[model samples]
Target: MGDILAHESELLGLVKEKDLVAAFDNGDQKVFFDLWEEHISSSIRDGDSFAQKLEFYLHIHFAIYLLKYSVGRPDKEELDEKISYFKTYLETKGAALSQTTEFLPFYALPFVPNPMVHPSFKELFQDSWTPELKLKLIKFLALISKASNTPKLLTIYKENGQSNKEILQQLHQQLVEAERRSVTYLKRYNKIQADYHNLIGVTAELVDSLEATVSGKMITPEYLQSVCVRLFSNQMRQSLAHSVDFTRPGTASTMLRASLAPVKLKDVPLLPSLDYEKLKKDLILGSDRLKAFLLQALRWRLTTSHPGEQRETVLQAYISNDLLDCYSHNQRSVLQLLHSTSDVVRQYMARLINAFASLAEGRLYLAQNTKVLQMLEGRLKEEDKDIITRENVLGALQKFSLRRPLQTAMIQDGLIFWLVDVLKDPDCLSDYTLEYSVALLMNLCLRSTGKNMCAKVAGLVLKVLSDLLGHENHEIQPYVNGALYSILSVPSIREEARAMVP
Candidate 1:
C-alpha cells in the first residue's frame, strides 16, 4: 500500500499544474518527453501495479492532448513512436478493462492513437478475423480515422496515410460493384419468373382447349390432328396429360381415337377412290399409333379419372379396334383387370365381354380360351348375382353355343350348368338376364352332344324352363319355349323332360 501511494505521488509530481502550464506556455513538448522518460517509460514497460497502470494511462491521455493540439509539433517519427508505445500498453492491458465500466468511455473517444499500431486494426478489412472482432475493430478504426481528419491531426495523415485511404476506397468500390451485380442478377431472376408465368398461362389455355375439344364439342378430324400435332413431342404430351382434366366420362378414349383415326374420304363422282394405304401412311408412321396413344391415355386416366369410369372408357374404345387380332393382343390385360376387387373393373369387364361376344372372331376366341370360359363361369356362379355380369355371361354363352366346338367346350367345362342355374334363379335374375339365359339354353340343346349334357341335368333344366313358361317377362317365355322344344327333340331327353312335368 505504501509503495502504491509513493507511485501515485510520483505520478502526480510528473504532471504537476505548474510544470504542465509552463510546458504549454513555453510551447515545449520536451516536458511531455521528460514526463515520459522520468516516470511513464518504466511504468509503461512494467506497469503491473494498479497505481503504475493508472499513471501509465494518465500519460497516454496527456499524449493524446499533445497530439491533438500539435502544441510543440512533435516530429512525425517521434509521434509514431509515442503512439506505438501507447498501442502496446492498451493491447496488453485492455482486455481486463474491456469487461469493466471503463471500456465504453475509452472506446467512445475519437482519438485512438494510430490503428496501424495494432495488428488486428491493421487487418481490419481482412476476412480472416471473426465478424465480431472485425466489427469492433472497424468501429475503433473509424473513430481514429475521423479524428485523424480533424484540423489538428490532418497533417499526420497527409504525410503517411495513403495506405489507409486506399484500403477504404477499395472497400467502397467493392461494395458498389457487389450492389451492381446484385441488381443485374435480380433483373434476370425477375425476367425468368415472368416468362415462367407466361408459359403457365399458355399451357393452361391449351389444356382448356383440349378438354373442350375432347368433350365432343367442335370435334373435327382436322382439329384433332392439329391438337395432336401440338402435343406430339414427349414434353408437350407429358405436360398436356398432367395439366388437362379428363374427368368427364369417355373423353380420354374419344380424344385418342379422334386424334389417331384416319380421315374418311368422301365419295365423289369424278375422283378416284382415295388410296387408304398411302393416306394411312401419311396419317401415322406406325399402326401402333393407336396402341401407343391408347396405352398412354389409359395410363393417364388410371391416375386422373374416377374409379368407375376408367375401365369402361378404356374397354369401350378397345372394342372399337378394327382388327380382332389387335383386340386379342390386349385381352390378357383386360382379363387380369376382370379379377380386380373394384366392382367398377368387374362391371366394365362384363361390358367388354358382351362387346366381344357381338363379334364372330371374338366369340370364337373366348369359347376356345378355357381360362376365359372359366372366368365367365365363375362370374356367373357368384352368389351375390351381379345382373350385368350374368347377362353378359349368358350372351357370351349364347355366342359360344352357336359354334359346335365352343358348345362342346362349354359342356366339358360344365358351363352349361351355369345357364341352368341362372334359369332356376328367376327370383334373382333380371328380365334381360332371363332372356339371355334361355337363349343360351336354346343354343346349347340344338346338338345331340349338348342334348346329352342337358339330359344329365334334365330334371333341373325341365323344372326351370317349365317355371319360365308363366314368367311375367313375356320376352323370356318365347326363349324358354324355344329352349324346351330343342331339349325335347332328343328322344331320351324328351322322355326325361316329360317325366319332369308337374
Candidate 2:
C-alpha cells in the first residue's frame, strides 16, 4: 500500500531471478513447501514497530512468491487457502511476517548464516573454518544487530517520538483502506473480464454460485449454479464457463450468439412449442400457473443452460399475440429481484426486464404494471451505490420514456426532478450514466407531461440543458436540444426563456 520497503529490492530481485527459482526447483518439493508453510505460519503476526512490521511483510511477500514458483506447484487450493488467510490478516491488522524467527535457514552473507532463514548454511563453516572467516562473521553480527535496532534508535532520538503510535495507526488505516479498495477493483476487473468472454463459452451451461465473497461463495440457490468467478485469472473463469457454466453474460449478446449453438434439442424443442397455439383453449384463463411454469422453464434454459433454443421463442410463446396474462403477472417476481442488493442479481434481472421492454408487447406489459418501472426509478434516485447497477437502471428508464404512459408515470413520480439534479453535477457521473440519463431526460421532456413538469422549474431545466451544450461528450447534444425544445414549448416557460435573454 506504500512504497516497497528497503528490503524489497532483495525480495523482488529473488522473484525476478526465474533462474534462481529454477535452480532451487527439483524432484523433492515437500521440504520447500513445508518450510514455506512453517515460516509463514509462525512469522506472520503483528510487529511492535513500523520498521519491524514492514520487515515481516517483506518475508510474506517472498513466501507468496514461493507458492507461485512453477516447478513445485502445489494444489491450487493450498495457494488459495494461504492467500485468503493472508489477506484476512492484512485486512484486520496489516500484512507482516517476522524476520527474527529462528525458522527457515538461509545465508545472507559470505558464509554468514542467517539464524532466521539461512541457519542451514552454518554447517558449511563447521568443516572449513578460518580466523578471517570468524572475524568476518563477528563483523556481520555487529552490522545485523545495528541494522535490527535502527528503528528503536530512531524512536529514541526523534523529536516527539511518541507520535509513532498515532502515525502507525493513521498509516495502517490508510494501508488497510487502500488494500481493500485495490482488492475490490481487482475482483471487479476479473468479473468484467470473465463476462466479456461469456459469448465465447457458448458450449457451457450458465451457473451462478459463489465460493467466497472476494466476489465470494453463493449461499443462495444460485451459489453453485455454474460460475467460476474464482481466484485464478484467465484460466479460472474459462474452465468454469466451459465445464461448469457458472455464469452467463447477462447481456443479450450471449443470448443471441448461444441461440445459434449446436446443442441438442427435442423433436419439437418444447420452448417454441406453444408459440402458435391459436386454439381458444391456448389462451391464458385464470392465474395461468401452467403458462408461468412454461415461462420459468424457458427462463433458466436461456440464462443458466446452453442455448437449447429461443429467448424470442419463449417471449412469443409466453405472450401470444392475443395474450399477456403471464407476462404482466410475473412483475411481482421481477420486483423482488429488482430490489435485490446484489449488483450481480440486479444486473441480470435488469437485463431480463430490458428484454421485456424491448418490444411493443413487452412495453405494453410493463405499462400495465408500472411497479417494475417505478422500482427502477426509485433505485436510480437513491444514492449511487453501484455504478453498473445505476447504469443499467438509467439505461432502462431511458428506454421507458419512449412510451408516453411510462413518461407520465415517471413524471408523476417526480423523475424529472432527479434527472435535473443529476445533470447539474455531471462531473460525478460516468460517461455512460451521463449519456443514458440525458437521453432519458430528452425523451421524457418531449412528452406533454414532461414539458409541463419542466415548466414548473423551467429556469433550472434551461440552465442544465444550456450547460450540457458545453459538455465534452458530443453525444448528449441531440438530447439537450430535444429537451430544450420541449421545455421551451410551454407559453410561460417560453416567456421566461425570452425574458432571460441579454
Candidate 3:
C-alpha cells in the first residue's frame, strides 16, 4: 500500500506537465495513461477487478485536469459523457458536474476499493458471510456514518520540525526531570514538617505537665525527684560533652599544633581543672550539683601528680581554720559534708581525707580531730551506702592506721574487731574492699592493742587469714602475709594457727 501511494504521488507530481513528464522522458507516460483509462472504463462497467485496487490520486487528477482546461480538447466528448454519468452517480459531492437532494458514496476513481471489494473487508467475510451480507454490512456502516454526520479525519500540524509523538515524548521527559527535583525537595519538606510537629507536641505536653504540677494535682514526691534527677542528668551530660577546661600544658589540640618542633602530646585528664582558690571556694559553697562536679575536679588534681604537695596545700587551710570549726559555712564546718546526702560529696571527702592522712603531719592533724575518723568508720559500717563511697571510707581508715596514734585510736574504737569480722567474708567484697581491708588489718595488728583485739576472736581471725592465703590478687597477698605474721605474735593466735590442719 505504501509503494502504491508513493508511485501514485510521483505520477500526480509530473501530471502538471503537458505529456506527464514523470512517466515519459524521465518516466513512462503511455503506460500510466493506458492503465488509468482501462481502470476507469472497467470500474464504470461493473466495479470488477479495478474495484479491488484503490487509485485515490487518479480520481482527483481527472477532476483537476478538466476543471483547468474547460475549452476544446481531444478527450472532451468522452470526458463530457463520463462526467455526465458520474454527475448523476456522485450527486452533491461532484456538484460542478451535477447536483442532487441526497448524498452519494461513488465519488471515487476506478480500481479504488469500495468497502465490499477491499481486501480487509473480503478477509472479514471470507468464509463467514456471503456476498449479500458484505453489501448489507457496507450499507449499515454508511447509514451509521450519515446518521452521526461524521467528518473525514484531519492530520495534526507539526511544531518546530517535531511531530506530535516527538513533542509528546519531550514533554514526558521534562515531566520526569521535574519529578526528580520534586522528590528531593519533598523529602526535605517532610522532614522539616515532622520536626516542627514533634516540637509542638513536646511543648504542649510540657505545658500540660507544668500546669498540673502548679495546681498540685496528680503529682507525687517521687515524680518530682525523678524529674529533678533527669534534668540534672541531662545538664551534666551536656556540660561534659561541651567542657573546655584545657588543663596542663600540651594537653589541648591547639597547643600541640602550635609547636614548630616535633613533640608528643600528653593524654588529657579525665576531668578539667580550675585555679586552686576558685576550686576551693566553689567546693565549699557551691550547690550540690556544682559540688559534685568540683569533687571530681579535686580528685583529678590530688591524684595525678605532686599529690603530697597538693595534700599539704589543702591541709594549710584546715590547719589555720581548725579541722572541726567553721571555714565560713553558716557555722557548720566544711568537713560536715562527709555526712551530706550526696554520695559524690561523701566519696570525694573520704578520698581527700585519705590523701590528707597519707602524710605524718596530715595524719597528726586528723588525729587531733577524731570526728572525721568516726564518720569514716560509720560509713564503712553502713551496708546499704554506695559501694564506692564505702570503699573510699575503708581506704581513709587504712591511711589513718599508718600513724601510731591513729592506729591506737582505731583499735580503741574496736575497728580491728570490725575489720576481722568483715575480712572473714572476703569473698563477698570487691577487690578494692578486700585489698583495703587486709592492708588496714595488717597495719592495726602491728600494734599490741590490735593483736589483743584479734586475740578475742583468735580462732576466727586465724581461719579468715588462712582462707585469704590462697587469694589470687598478688597485691592483696603482701597485705595478707603481713597481717598473718603480725597477728600470730599473740601466743593464743599462734596456738590457734598451729592447731589448724595444713
Candidate 4:
C-alpha cells in the first residue's frame, strides 16, 4: 500500500510538471508506455478504491493516446507485451476482488474493454453486477468471437467447462433479447436498427422463433419458402420506398450509413458453414432487391443538398456493394434509374464520374450505357455553353470520354465551341465562373481526343487568363494561373499563345 501511495504521489508530481503530456506528443512511445505501466501496476498492487478507479481511467486514457499516435506502423510486439502484462495484472486483482462481495464492482470495471477500440464498454457493464452477468458475458464473448480467428480463447473456454450448446444457446437468447430491445430503442435511435449484422441476427431469430411456434405440418420447407417470398416481395419494396426516401437526406439514410460503416473484412462474421451455400444462392436470387436499395440510396446521394449527406451517401453506396456482387446483371436497373432521371440525378452522376477516375472505372463504363449519355447530352443547356458548374460537368464529360473517346470526340468539339461562345460573353466572364470554366477546359485539353480539341479552346483560355491576371481574389488568381499554365504546357495551346503574342 505504501509503495502504491508512493507511485501515486510520483504520478501526481509528474502530471504537475510542465510538458509531461508532451512526452506523448513528441512520439516517445516508450515513455508513454512506461508512465501507463507504472501507474496501472501500482494501482493494481495497492487496490485502493480510489486508485483502482483511477487505474481504469488512466488505462483508457493512455490506450487511446497511444493508439491515436501510433496509427501508422505501431510497435506490435511491444503492444502485445503490454497487453499481456495488463491482462495478467487485471486477473490477479480481479481474483482478489472475487473473494469479497464488496469488490464486485471492480470485476465489472475489469471487464469493460478499452473504449477506443470497442465503444460499448458502458453498455457492456450495465448489468455486470446483476444475475445477468453470464448472459452479458456471453454476448461480449460472441461479439469478440466474430472478430477472433484464433481458437485459443474458445479452447480455453471449453476447457473451463463451457459447453458448445451453452454457448450457442446464450448467443441465440442474447440476440433475441437484443432484437426486442432494439426495436423499442430504434424509435429514439434508428441507427441500432440499421446495423446489418444486428438486423441479420435479429431477423434470423425471428424466423427461428416463428418456425418453432408453428405446428410440424405447417413448418414444411414449402411454407418457409413462401414466408421468405412474401417477406422480400415487391410489396416490401414499395413499403420500403414509401417508408423513407433513402435518396432524400433523412434519418434513415444517416442511420444506414452509421450501421454499415466499414469494419475490417476479417472482423466481419464468417458465413456459418451450414448457411454459406444458401447465403450465396440468396444473394444471387435477390439481386433485384439489392439493386432497388442501391438505386434509392443513390438517389439520396443526388437529392441531398448538404455536404454531409453527399459524403454519407458515397460511403453507403460503397457499403451496399459489399453485400451484392459487383458484376451482377441487376446493376443495369440502377443504371436505368440514373438514365431515367438525368436532371435530378446530376450531382450523383457527377460524383460517380469523379469516383470512376479513382475507384469505379468499370462501373462507370457499365453505367454509361448509350441511353444515359444521350440523356446527358439532351440536358445540356445554352448556359452550360460557358461551363458554369464546370467542375461537375467536366467530371461527367471525363467519364463519357473514358467510356467512348471516339464517339465523344464530336460531342467534345460541340461543347468546346459553346465554351468559347460563353467565354466571349462579357456578362458570363466573372472571376468565379471563369476560374471553373478554365479548369474544365484545361482538363478537357489534357484528354487524348481533347488534344485535337485544344486549338479551338485556346483563344478562350488566353482571354480568361488575361482577365484573371488582375483579379482581386488571391485564391482565384493562383487557380486561374495554374489552369493557364496547364493549357500553355500543351503544344497546340503553346502555339496558340505564341500566335496571339506576335
Candidate 5:
C-alpha cells in the first residue's frame, strides 16, 4: 500500500506538470492517455486522498482537448476507450466519490462543446451514485436527450416502432427517482441551491426535448400540452418569487420554444374555456402577485429570442378574451411592465405593440371593448407627452391603425385632437415631439376615415407642416413633407393645402 501510494503521488505530480498538459496540447493523445490511465488505476487501487480531484482535473483537461481538436475528427475510438477506462476507475474508487461535491465544469461543458460534432463524455459517469455526481449526470443526460439525431440506443427503439410516448414514459420514470433525489439534495445542500437551479434548467430542457421528439407520435397532444402548460406555469411561478433575470437566468424557455416549434395547434387541444370573469376576479384579488408574474413573464418573453412565442402566449392569455377583460384584468399588469426600469420589459412592450398592430381587426370581440380601446388611446396620449417613449408608442399605434382602420376612428380623432393641441403651442411644433406626432397622424390618415379626418384637421396639419418646413433640421423636413403629401392627397384637404401655400 505504501509503495502504491508513493507511485500514485508521483503520477499526480507528473499529471500536473506543465509539460504533460503541453504534450496533450501537442497532439500526444496516446502518451497523455497512457499516463492518465496509469495514474487513475493506481490511485483507485491505493485509495489516494486526492483521487477525486485528479479525476476532475483529467476530465476538464480531456474536455478541453476534445473541444480544441477532436471536433469532427473520425478517430474517437481512442477517446471512447479512455473514457471507458475512467468510468471503470470511478467505479473501482467508489469510496472517493464523496470527497468532491462540486462539478461546475460538468454542468457547463455540455453547453460549450459542439454536441453535433463531438459526443459528450457523460456516459462515463452513468453509474455515479453521489448526489453531486447524479445532478451532473442529469444535466448530461438532458443534453444528450435533446439531440434531434437519433442516438445509438434510440435507433433500436425507432426500428422496433416503439412509440415516442413509450420512450418518454420510460425516460420519465428514470428521471422521477432522480427528481426526488435532487429535491433531497437541495434540502441537504442549501448552500448549493444555485446549482440545483441548474438542475431545474436541465429538467426544463428534458421536458422540451420530450415534447419535440414525440410530436405527432403516440404521445397525445393533450399530454404534451399539459406538460407545456405545467412547465411554463412552474417557470412563471418560480421566476416571480425569485429575482430571476431571465436575460440569462439560464432557464430553458429559449430551448423549449425551439423544440415546440414543430408542434401543431391541433396537438394542443383548444384550451378548455375558463370562466374568464372568475379568472379576472381572482387576478384582481391577487393583483400584486399576478403583476409580479406578469412582469417576469414579459421580461422572459421579450428579452429572449423567442418573442414570437411569448407574444402568442400573451395574446391567448390577454387579448383573445373580451377586450374589457384584458384591460380590466391586465391593464395594471401591462402598465407595470411598461413602466418597469428593466430594458427587457420596454423592448417586450415594443414587440407586443407591433404584434398587436399586425393582428388587429374589427372583430366583434375587440370592437366591443371600449375600455381596452380607451387604455390603448391612453397609452398614445401619455406617449405624446414623454419624449422617451413617444417613438415606440407612435409606431405601435400606426401599425394598429393600419390593420384596423374602422376601429381607429376614435384613435384618429385623438390624433387630430393632439395635432390641434400641439399646433396651438408654437414651441411644441418646433420640438422633436412634433415629428413623431406628425408621422403618427399621417399613419392615422392613411386609414379608412383617416383621410376625411385629416381634412377636418387640415388647418392644424398645415400649420405644423409650414412651421416644420421652415426649420433647419433636414430630418424633420422629410417627415413633415411626407405628412403634407398624405394630407394634401385627400381632395378635401387639397383646397386647404393650396390656401396654406398661397
Candidate 6:
C-alpha cells in the first residue's frame, strides 16, 4: 500500500505537470493512456484510500481523452477491464451528488472509448435522475457535438440505431418538460437562464441528429418557436421587475443589449417573438433616449458578424425575431416620431425604416400608414448631407412599392422621379442597393398605372437601362431587362425605348 501510494502520488504529479489537453495536442496520447492504465491497476489493488486520492481533475482529463481519441480503434481487452473497473468506482461515488460534481463522472460514461463500455449510456440518461444532473449531462453532450464534427454521443447513436430511438424520445420529452417548469415555476432569473440554455443546447443536437438520421416527427418548428417565445417572455418579465432609466446614454441601450442577447441554439433557426406593444409602451414610446438606444442596438445586432471561422455566418434567429416589425406597427406612434424636427431623431428613424423594410409585413404596415409614407417620401426629396439617410429612405420606398397598393400610394408620392434620379446619379451605388432600385422599377412597370409613370420618365429610364446593359454587373441585367420589357411592351414607349437601345 505504501509503495502504491507513492506511485499514485508520482503519477498525479506527472499528470498535473503535463496538462491533459496539452498532452493530447502534443501527440502524447499513448503515454497518457499508459499512465491511466498504471493508475487504475494501482488503485484497484491499493484500496479505496488510494482510489480517493486519484483526484477529480485526473478523471476529467481521462474522460476528455476518451472522447477526444478513443473512437474507431479495435477493442482492447486490457482497456475494457480498466474501464469496467473505473465504471464501478464511479457508480459507487455518484449517489445524490451536487450538480457541480455530478457532471465530472457522468461525462465519461458516453465517451468511454470502448463500444461495450457505454452500451447503455442512453439507458443511464432516460432512467430516473435529478433534473440538474440531466441538464448538465445534456449540456456536456451538446458541447461535445459543437466542438467537433463527430461527437461520441452521435457516433453511439449511429452505430446503435433502433436502440437509441426510445432514449432520444425520452430525452426530448424531458427537455420540453424541464423548459416548461423553468419558465413557469423558477423565479431566479440566472437559474432559469442556465436551465433553458442547456435545454436548448441539447435540443439543437437532438433536432439535427434526428433530422439527418430519422424521418419521423420528433420536434416541429412550431414547437421550437413556442419554446423560444416562452424563454423570451421569461427574460423580459424578469427585466421589467426593476426600473430602467432610458435617458442616460447607454443606460437603456446597455440594458436592452444584455437583456435581448439572441437566444442561440446550434443549428436551430427559431427566434423568440417580441410583444411590440409591451416593449414600446414600456421602453420606447415617450422617451427619446430609450428610442435612440433601441435604434443603436438594432443597428449593432444587424451588423455584427461572428468570428471568421465560425460555421454559421449570420444569426437567422435575430433576423426572424421581428422586433422592428412590432415597433413599426405600434398604432403609428413610432411613425409619428419619425417626423420629429431633430436631425438625430431623423437619422435614427431612417435607420429604423431601413430595418423595418427588410420584412414584407413591416413594409405593408408602413404602406398602410399614410403619414409614414409621406415622411419617407419627403426625406427622399430633401438634399441631406448624410447619404445613408437618403439611401435608407429610398430603400424603404423600394420595399413598400413591392406591394401593389403601396406602389400606387408611393407613385402618388413621386417615387418614380426619385428612382430615375438615383439611377442617373454619377456616383456608383452598391450592387445590392442598385438591385433594390431595379427590382422596385420591375414591380412598378408590371402594371398600367406604373407603366404610365415609367412612360413619363421613359427617356431618362431608357438612358439608365442602356447604360446598365453595358455595365459589368450581371446581377442587375435581369431586373433591367424586366423593367425594359414592361416599358417597351407599352405601345406608347416602345419606339422611344428601342431608339435608345443602341
- Find the candidate with the highest TM-score and give its number: 3
lDDT for model 2, please: 0.54
Candidate 3 lDDT, 137-244, residue by residue in tens: 234334433422323232113233456677699899999999999999999999766655554444445556788978887744444333333323243535433343
lDDT minimum window of 10 residues, candidate 5: 265-274
lDDT scores in order: 0.54, 0.54, 0.57, 0.45, 0.49, 0.56
Residue-wise lDDT of candidate 4 within 273-383, one digit each (tens)? 112233334323434433232333333333332334344444444434532233444553333333333343444444444444333433354353444444344444422
Q: CA RMSD for every model?
A: 34.6, 24.0, 42.8, 27.0, 26.2, 25.4
Runs of candidate 3 with Cα error greater than 4 angstroms are 1-285, 305-331
Model 3 residue 41 lDDT? 46
lDDT, residue 152, model 2: 56
Residue range 96-136, candidate 5, lDDT tens digits = 44233353223323222233232333433333323354344
The C-alpha TM-scores of every prediction are 0.35, 0.39, 0.42, 0.30, 0.36, 0.39
Q: After superposition, how far is residue 332 of candidate 1 from its true place, in Å?
A: 7.1
lDDT for 431 (candidate 1) = 69
lDDT of 4 at 3: 73
Question: Higher lDDT: candidate 2 or 4?
Answer: 2
lDDT string, candidate 2, 336-435, tens digits: 5556555555555556566566556566666666566767887777636667767877877777778877778888999889899988999888999898
Q: In candidate 1, what are the lDDT values of residues 1-502, reduced to their tens digit?
A: 9779766755565345345445533434457446434533353335434434343444344435444446566577766565555544444544345334433234212233343244323333244423443244234334433443355666556745886887799999999999999999999999766655554444555656777878876655444445544534344566555555455556555655655547565532221112233222322332233223222323332233333334344333333432222324444344554454545445555665666676565565565446776777677677253556566666766776787877777778776787787567787767677777777777777767777888887788788888889878865654576677677877777788667656
Candidate 1 residue 11 Cα shift, in angstroms, is: 77
lDDT for predicted candidate 6 compared with the true structure = 0.56
Model 2 per-residue lDDT at 125: 38
Relative to the true structure, candidate 4 reaches a TM of 0.30
Choose the strongest candidate by lDDT: 3
RMSD of 1: 34.6
